[model samples]
Target: MRLEQALRSGRHLSTADPTEAELLIVNTCGFIDASKDESISVIRDLDSSRRKGQQLYVVGCLTEIAEAEVRATIPNVDATFGAEQWDAVAASVGPASANFDIPQPEFTNIKQPSAYLKISDGCDRPCTFCIIPTIKGAMHSDTVSRLIAEAKAHARDGTRELVLVAQDSTAYGEDQGDREGLATLLEQLSEAVPDLPWIRLMYAYPGRVTRLLAETMARLPNVVPYLDMPLQHASPSVLRRMKRPTVNKSRESINHIRKAIPDVVLRSTFIVGFPGETDSEFEELLTFIEEQRFDHIGAFTYSAQKGTPAATLLEQVPEAVKIERYGRLMELAQSISHDQNREMIGQEMKVLVESAEPTTSADGSPVVIGRTYRDAPEVDGLAFVKGEFKPGSMVDVRVEGALPYDLLCSPLDFHKP
Candidate 1:
């Protein structure tokens, strides 16, 4: 949203140095207490800095969460707008505001080869531990036409890979009936940009991955065979308390996805501790994770979200217990991930070269660093190679070594299809 605002307003801003800018605006994500404090501190710094030729505006979820409080507490801010008040922010910028080319933030595989396009905003999940529905309100998916147009723009920008992001990608097109579902959207996107080699989806709900949706992924050549399904918790009792679908249904959904797409890379996240969760319930979760060794697993310890129903529940898991459980889950995931990667050794894999690792005096030689379809930019691991492969070029890689999170390999120069 920040980048879009700057692009629309035709303004250039710098995170490196702000003392020289005329108008300064800070976009804040005050979803939690810590984030709120950080926003306040930034606002206070801007207020106290009192730099010449500088103005400040505040916007984002923080403003929506505490609009009045922010205004009164941070009077130094010239203006404040909520999540819905983008028009006001756009109007605030005058002719003097500048603009710069903003590339999407990609931590790895960032060889100017990948781009991220947000297809939708907000979520409809009623999870008791989430604030997305409260802050961003109900489902509001972007139209398929607009998404295709934006994606085409990226393709023209020389983006070979595009990652689709949303609060809930699987809930796409739910707001409108005439819109064919996510499956249709994927099929349309594949047709829209046949030249763009790779298209990936992120943050899709496991429950929404219907059989047809799984099949669409299999049918679309450009779409990578990977799924990022964040099932916060797996125990049926805990899932019900969190307002999630039945655990058995989620399991069946996974089964269908794997059965239909044999090579699918499954990435999922879980919350180790939630309010009212007993050790026995957590043991159920541990057993569940053991059974489902997801290709990529991320775990987080539960924290209190102020406006969430989970926050008010009694028997809140202690911080110590949460950390302990979180540690155990991570430890188990490391072992499982290592074992999973070990299975890939010596297998020929297709990797999109993303960076060129320079050789130093002590280092052996230069190599093309990149990622496979299984890895998402920044969030997942990477593959390192040392050979003639060029950055931003696709190459065949033979996995020579594998670790819990990183893959090491050498390029196959002579191998031909």
Candidate 2:
């Protein structure tokens, strides 16, 4: 989004084809080893294929973590900037067009119904497996007033759903020592932008989720009952090695949240094959998953990121073991997901229409693709609706059929409330 803002400020037109553009901005992610490899591949590919006079700038987390490596290895990159250096990037690209004024707080180029509002940046946590703190620094939150203004702007610009994001969402305002910061912000945003249909929260730290926060979510009609708390592992021993809160604490937190919001859709990610994770520990994680019955689960094999404490831990799990564990975990998660989806059959849900393209179903009838409140924008499943609707419109959908991850629905009616 910063890149988009920079381009708009410079009055540069976006091109779908990289070959057609004079300058290509490669914003990269360095969250994991896999992401880093992918970013490198993209940079190399773009550099190799660029026409004469084309400029390539690499920016973001990858640059922050490995600027020296990027500059040394990718000689075609004209410059590299960290995630927070948008001003330098703008300066390198020249000034804003005389006629164009940069929009404040909101991106005018964004036309999606769902938007991510990053209320805070960076992290202060010492999770042994994470390198985010090293790359992005400590937690810094935007003021409540500023975030509220941004939320209102998003609503005015056709965004119906807002997903509040941060490295540790529940830890918002702790840097400034306000314990009830996130709760206060949510209340203000709800009142300020009543038009936004769904306000979802992600990347919440379990320890930081105060009772007031949960209560605020339950009270706010727009704040959808969904929580994305990434509990990296379930075994107490593994969690200890990861420098995370105990598994008992996690269980207690989940139980409290479930009791507070009975219909809450829980989403989480887990890391399999953490160092020294025995078969018994893995079984413990599996049992926890079975007991929790989360609406969505993402399982990943632990990547031994460089410069992290876990990288040098004893008894590193083998690659084959990691792969096997990942498969087993995902297979179990799929069964749970299937059961959860099947339970929603014959239920009515409010679906945010994503795409209304002309496509015939198996019976040669047209259908639309949308998502329910339970599904986050890109990471989760979609709802296929048999109806004529405009993109970004919300409508009522009756689940006629269910797959393990998606829903086949018939449009009931257009939803106003």
Candidate 3:
């Protein structure tokens, strides 16, 4: 998504190159079987080119999760590391052989407007269906001062938005100090880097989400009205079996946000057909989705992740049942999304123009595409506007139409200076 959008506008993106490029990296997500499979597939494509003079490295969750396995399989890897290995990767690639350091993250920030700033490492939550804790380890948050400094650097570097990410963002400071916790850190971050246009939070757990967090978000102008409030499942029984200690408080949380800021966007993810999940539990999930009518909804089927508690649980769901449940959840989300998008059709909204794609229109006119603040880079949607829009230029546009993901809009070019 970043390449397709950024490269179209003459922007230099930093991933993947022809066999001749000086450096190459295989960024992997080793959280689940599917992601692991995808990462290995990429590794295989490069593993055979040993004779070819190329500098290759592997990083991310897989580096730590299955480090031994990866080393055995892909011995050609010059370097292998995870979240804590950024410094090591730097040294391996640069003159600084050790304690290597730099101002910017070497890996490409694939999204527009909002660049992901991984503030903390690992997961503290004991969600049974998750493998992040096993793969990424326990939570180890970066110092608040460093985070503040980084946010300022990003702002000065032209990043309009800062996306705070961690396995459990809410647990950022628990492992460190007294003045920790994601909510408090967020408040300080906004204070430290007030110029940043938006700060969006992601990977937040349901139970750890305190009342103060909502208030903090509401008070902070830069904090985007969007929240990735991942409520894995709503059924109390399933939640218990899954070791998701969080009591289902979707109603209270949703109501508080709505009461405070009526326009807030709540994004959530769910997993259907979990181990021992029954018809009643499935119905509860359906009811939760119906009641939530979330602005954004992401759902997945039960996939066994090694070392997760749920993986060993009895009554494993059949593939067919998992697929069926996923389909139904998706269908419900789509219907709700269509209606929500329809409501946005007539509204004038601010969109951060991404990049232009070279394509002919139906009538043979040139066209460019982009996204609004509400739409994330790849996972969410796009704004297809037939006009001259410079990537990174924030502009206002009237929402002309809508689909499940992409939105159609006409640019209000006059709004820009």
Summarize candidate 2's per-residue lDDT along 87-187 as a digit string, tens digits: 78888998645575545445555677899999999998889988899989989998888788778778988998999999999888888999888998899
Writing each residue's lDDT as its tens digit, candidate 3 over 1-417 gives 222222223322354444655556777887766678888888877777634677678888887778888888877787787745655555556542234333334233344456777778777677888877777777888888877866776676677778888777877777876433777888898888887777888877765667777788889988888878778889988888877754446566666666667888778888888998898899998998888788778887888877787889889999898899999998998888788888899899877766644344587865567777676555666777766666666677898889987788777764467
Positional deviation of residue 11's Cα in model 1 after best superposition, in angstroms: 5.5
After superposing candidate 3 on the true structure, give the runs of residues whose Cα lies further than 4 Å from its correct spot.
Answer: 1-20, 46-51, 67-79, 91-112, 176-180, 356-360, 413-417
TM-score to native of every candidate shown: 0.84, 0.93, 0.85
Tell me model 1's lDDT, rounded to 2 decimals: 0.79
- lDDT: worst 10-residue window of model 2: 100-109
Give per-residue CA lDDT, model 1, range 175-220, as digits (tens): 8763337888899999999988889988888667888888889989
Give stretches of model 2 more than 4 Å off: 13-20, 48-51, 68-74, 96-109, 413-417
Residue 187, model 2: Cα distance from true site in angstroms: 0.8
